[model samples]
Target: MQAGNLVLLLVALGAVFYFFGWRRSYAVSAPLGGVRHLHSLPGYYASLAAVWCVLPALALLGLWLIIDDAVIRTNLMASLPSSIQPANEVDYNLLLNQIRNVAGGALNPAFVPAEVVAAAEQLVAMQARNQQMMSIAFVSIAVLGGVWGWSRVQPRLRARQQVESVMKWMLMGSATVAILTTLGIVLSVLFESIRFFQKVSPVEFLFGLQWSPQIALRADQVGATGAFGAVPLFAGTLLISFIAMCVAVPVGLMSAIYLAEYAHRNVRAWAKPILEILAGVPTVVYGFFAALTVAPAIRGFGESMGLTVASESALAAGLVMGIMIIPFISSLADDVITAVPRAMRDGSLALGATQSETIKRVVIPAALPGIMGGILLAVSRAIGETMIVVMAAGLAANLTANPLEAVTTITVQIVTLLVGDQEFDSAKTLAAFALGLMLFIVTLGLNVIALKIVKKYREQYE
Candidate 1:
């Protein structure tokens, strides 16, 4: 049977067990007076039986799928002629892929040697047998588990406690999986970054002024002497992010403040959602707007004002990116500002302070921690944005602070370096990992600072 069909069958069986256990519990309790005399409800017994029927069956199915491919490949290789055996892991994988393609009818048997055709036939037979065995075993186990659980359903079964215990452990397991996944990502990047630093000095990568990353393929190749200096990239990222923050902070905060404090209820209801709709628009759409509309407009305006501007200028990208990130700042700040105690605002006003003065002093100070966190998150979003920067800011890693000139960010270069057929051993490709590590560290630092700010100033009013 197919995996999807088998899963459906398992679900059907679990449902059967659920209803059976529920009715059985009532039947068993009838002789003992009523269901009120039972230790747990009929629903708990039903849930317990369902869990028993599904858990072992799902576990076996998962295990079978994990090992089935390797077992089939091993047996297939054993049946091949000694001379036809693959030489290395890469060749072995290639051979397996060809076999899979042939077995799945994607490749014609006449195009390959007779030995491969024979192996493909064996692969198909083995897969059919494996699926048959797996289906039989899983169904048998699920039925046995259901029978066992149903037989135990009685006045004193303690079904609720058992089901609740299982659910609690499942929830904990889910949390552990999330934490481990995050740790795994960090370790993988850190290890690859270590390898990258082995090829290039940390100091040179961090502090060097030039930003070329092209490694020469031949000694005679001109302008390919790779300079791994990252200063220009860092400077460009900071310059664009600073410009974005400048545009975003005042506008987003003011809008948030107005909605939270001064806006009429009807106006707040409509305007807040309309403003947040900017966040829902895809970054690529924003990128297109930056490239075609914003960049050309900035260049034309600069020309009109007798100022030089790159055709793809950072100002255009930064401005659009700021516009893109406004919702992040506005939404979070609005929530935080609105959460400030109404009594605090009233108390400030009761002391002869104007409404604006109360907001500037009493409300903002109390909500500043959360507002700072929102701003930092917006800044992080600005730093990590790629599409708008790529579309508007040209890929020149110029070490300049001028927003009218073209520049590139670390993320843009990382994408450039690893976009195509990249050899992992090359410094050019490995540099992406190093750049990723730096970006991760920078983001982590920002989070830490935000957390500290929140901790230090949180609940001052309370």
Candidate 2:
């Protein structure tokens, strides 16, 4: 049976066990002055039986699925003639792909050798047999587990505690998986970054002023000396992020304050969602706007004012990015401000403070930590934005702070380095990992700073 169908069958079996266990508990308790004689609730007994019926069967199904494909592939490879056997891992993978294609009727059998066609037939047969065996095993396990759990139901059984313990372990397992997944990602990136650092010095990658990463394979290649200096990228990133924040912070904060304190009920009901609609608009659409409309306007205005502005300027990208993230800051700040205790405001007003003074001194201070966190999140969003920057800000690694100049960011460089046909071992490609590691570190530092600020403000208020 298919995995989905098998899972459904297991669930049905578990449901049957649940009913049986519930009935058995009631049947056993009825003789001893009803269910009052039982140690735990009937629902807990039913849940414990359902868990017993499902867990072991699902575990077996998972293990079989993991090993089935490898075993099948290995047996197929063994059956192939020595002369036709693949010489390397890549060649073996290719051979297996062709076999799969033939088995699935994607490849015409008459065009290929008879050996390949025969192997495809064998593969189909083995898979059918494997599925049959798996279905039988899964059904048997589920049935046996259901019977055992039903038989185990007793008057004094602590089925509630047992079910709770199982759920607790399941939750812990889920948390462990999440933590391990994050660690795996970090370790993979860190290892690749270490390899990159061995090829290019960390000092040069971090502190050097230029950012070219094209390593030449031949001596005659031009402009491929691979200057891995990341300073220009960092400067451009900070400059654009600063411009975005300049536009976003005050506007978003003021909007939040107004929405939270001054807006009418009916107005707020419609206004908040409409305002936050910007967050739902795709970043690519913002990029298109930045590239087609904003960039041209800025360039045209600059030329009219006798200033030289690049066609793709940082100002255009930053402005659009700021507009895009405004919803993020405003929504978060509005929620935080509204969450402040109504009693605090009432107390402030009772102390002969004006509404404006109460908002500025009382409400703002109480909500400061959350507002700051929202701003920090917006700043991170600005730094990590790629599409608008790529479309509006041209990929020129010029180390100038001018918003009118075209520049590139770390993410842009990372994308550029890894694009097209590139060898993984080359410094050009490895440099992408180095850039990623740098970006990760910078973001981590920002998070640390945000946490410290939040903690300080929270302590002061509390």
Candidate 3:
């Protein structure tokens, strides 16, 4: 049978066994007359029981299947003859891939050496035997486990309670997995950043004013030493983010107010998603728009006002990024505004307050926490944005905050630092990790603060 058909058969058998047990329990008890016991749960409990039993086991089976190939390949590498092994780690890795492809029947025999071919054949045979044995063992275990679980069911089993507990644990496990993944990522970045810090002193990297990252490609090249000072990059990030917030906060909040409070339902239906479409446009498209359209316009407008503006300007990039983040702020603000209780509005109106007054004094204050949360998130996004700044804002890492001048951001610098072929252990490449670490920390701190504010707001409502 096909694998899918076999799975279906096993599921059907498990279901049959579960219902059979449930029916036997009911038959023995007959708590009330045939259908008179209103408290007795319906026969669907059997199906739920079958799902609970089968799903976990099947999940384990699926995980094992996914990992089995990698495990087998690693084992086969460990079994390779010392004479056949490549000299260096990189070459050894190349040989391992060739052996894997040959073993998996993806490579022609002519392409493989005799030793490799012999080893691949033996490994493939072993893997096939192992898989066959594992499959049989898994099926047997699943059947036995399902039968055991089903047999425990009775009139007094409290199956619903047990199911609920299991569901709660499943949800907790899912949450733990998400948290663990995030923690793992942070730890990895932190370790790499520490390595970078060892090469470049923290004080110099953090406080230095110059931001040039270009390094000598050859030993004899002579030039001014590349400075790793990060202040200018961070300053640029903050300047852009500030400009973006200035543009986005007012426009987004006002738009949200109109949509949530004043607009008719049909108008809202059309307008909200239309506004969100701004968010759907890719950042690369926004980058070019900022570079080609916004930048030139800003320069021309600046010249007309007798102010000098670079052709590639931070203002243009910031403005475009602000536009990109408007939906984030407005959508969240709208939700928070709408969540204000109808009773609060009625009470204000009854007290002779105008709609505008009521909204300003009561609704906004109530929704302030959620709105702040959204703004914080927007700031994080603006700080981390790369494409727009890289294309529209010039790479000159000006430490000044003048919007007319060019500036570089942390993300842009990180990209430049690591973009071309370079040694991973070099100070230049490792500098990217340090920048990444700082970015992660800043964003994480913002999120935590936002969450705390939002949580406090929720408590007020509750």
Looking at model 1, residue 148 earns an lDDT score of 85
TM-score winner between candidates 2 and 3: 2
lDDT, residue 21, model 2? 92
For model 2, residues 330-410, the per-residue Cα lDDT tens digits are 999999999999999999999999999999999999999999999999989998999999999989999998999999999
Q: What are the per-residue Cα lDDT tens digits for candidate 1 across 219-272?
A: 789756688999999999998899899999999999999999999999999999
Q: lDDT tens digits, residues 272-386, model 3?
A: 9999999899999999999999999999999999999998888999999999999999999999999989898899999999999999988998888989999999999999999
lDDT measured at residue 287 in model 2 versus the true structure, 0 to 100: 99
The parts of candidate 3 lying over 4 Å away from their true place are: 1-44, 55-94, 104-108, 217-219, 223-225, 304-307, 420-422, 451-462
| Predictions in order: lDDT | 0.92, 0.92, 0.83
RMSD of 1: 2.0
Candidate 1 clash pair list = none
Q: What CA root-mean-square deviation does each model show from the true structure?
A: 2.0, 2.0, 3.8
